[model samples]
Target: MTIYQKVQAVNHLFNQLDKDLGSFQQSTGLGCVANCGLCCLKPDINATALEFLPLAYHLLLNGETEQWLEQLQNNTEDKLCPVLNKVIAPGSKGFCSDYAHRGLICRLFGFSAMLHKNNTPTLVTCKPIKEQKPEAVAKANAHIASKDNYPLISNYYMQLRSIDESLGEELFPIRIAIEKAIYAVLAYYAYRELPSKDDIV
Candidate 1:
């Protein structure tokens, strides 16, 4: 498939996941604390290039791909996700600069489940949710166990791989994944026609 096709497929997957997660969140009442972005501050966050394809394509359409590449290259320290707009003031919450184009992990963290070795589904969530919403978390786990409709991390990832196996399978530090996605788009257009205004929107 073409680069744009791959991006569309990924975005479609994201859209469906968003809807499912919304329902899952409504059912469980487990959600992120308002304006909280501590999860984005983690230094070891990893992702796949496929998940960032939409973000890369967005930068490309906005004529900011090179600028983003430079910014990512300059981020040799701290290694936080460059997409994360970190809050500088004490006690303030940060946010994603490009929320609409955030990767799958961003969407999955608090609202999805993973199969444990014993084949039971466990909600893969952060400590804040566990600590603050203990009852909800427990209820959500039970919901996942009893219902097959809850989003499964493995199933979503498998769908991603079906789009483009190469970009979907490997994981890199968040910035690196974004960089690779940018490069993939750049290379795609290098020898082909550029997108028009209507193409990206």
Candidate 2:
């Protein structure tokens, strides 16, 4: 399939995930924990090259691709994610400046579910939830007991890997992934410019 097709497939999966999350949220009433940027601060958040392409696409569309790439490269520090906006208040409600282009890691972590090797469902959440809503935790445990479902990071990567043997398989630290994502966007547009809707395929 073409790049646009691939992007569309990824987006479709996101839509399915959204429906699932909506149900999960309504059932549990356990929203994202407060002031939670722990995942953001995580030293190692993994993302695939395929997962990053859309982000690059977004940067290209915004006409910020080259400049953003240069800025990311110039910042020798490997720890900070280039797209991470610290000023946006360190909470779950805070969002990435470029939400549309967020990598798989960005899209999956907080809202998604995961499966255990033993085939159990596990929620992708942070410490605050475990602390603030013990009852929610209990309900989640009961939810798991139902063996309903969860977003398994590994499970998703399997499909991603199937798309491009090299792509969805590997994960990079969030910063490097963001850096590469930015570069990819710039490179795509620099070489051929944005495709008209009819030319997207």
CA lDDT of each prediction against the hidden true structure: 0.90, 0.65
Model 1 bad stretches (over 4 Å):
88-94
Which residue segments of model 2 deviate by more than 4 Å? 89-95, 111-117, 183-193, 196-201
lDDT of 2: 0.65
For each candidate in turn, the TM-score is 0.94, 0.81
lDDT of 1 by residue, 8-32 (tens): 9999999999999999989889889
Model 1 steric clash pairs: none
Error of 1 at 79 (Å): 0.7
Per-residue lDDT over 20-132 for candidate 2, one digit per residue giving the tens place of the 0 to 100 score: 66776667766766556667766677777777766665555556667876786787675766667666665534646666656667766755567667766777777777788
Error of 2 at 196 (Å): 4.1
Q: All candidates: CA RMSD in angstroms?
A: 2.2, 3.3
Report RMSD for candidate 2.
3.3
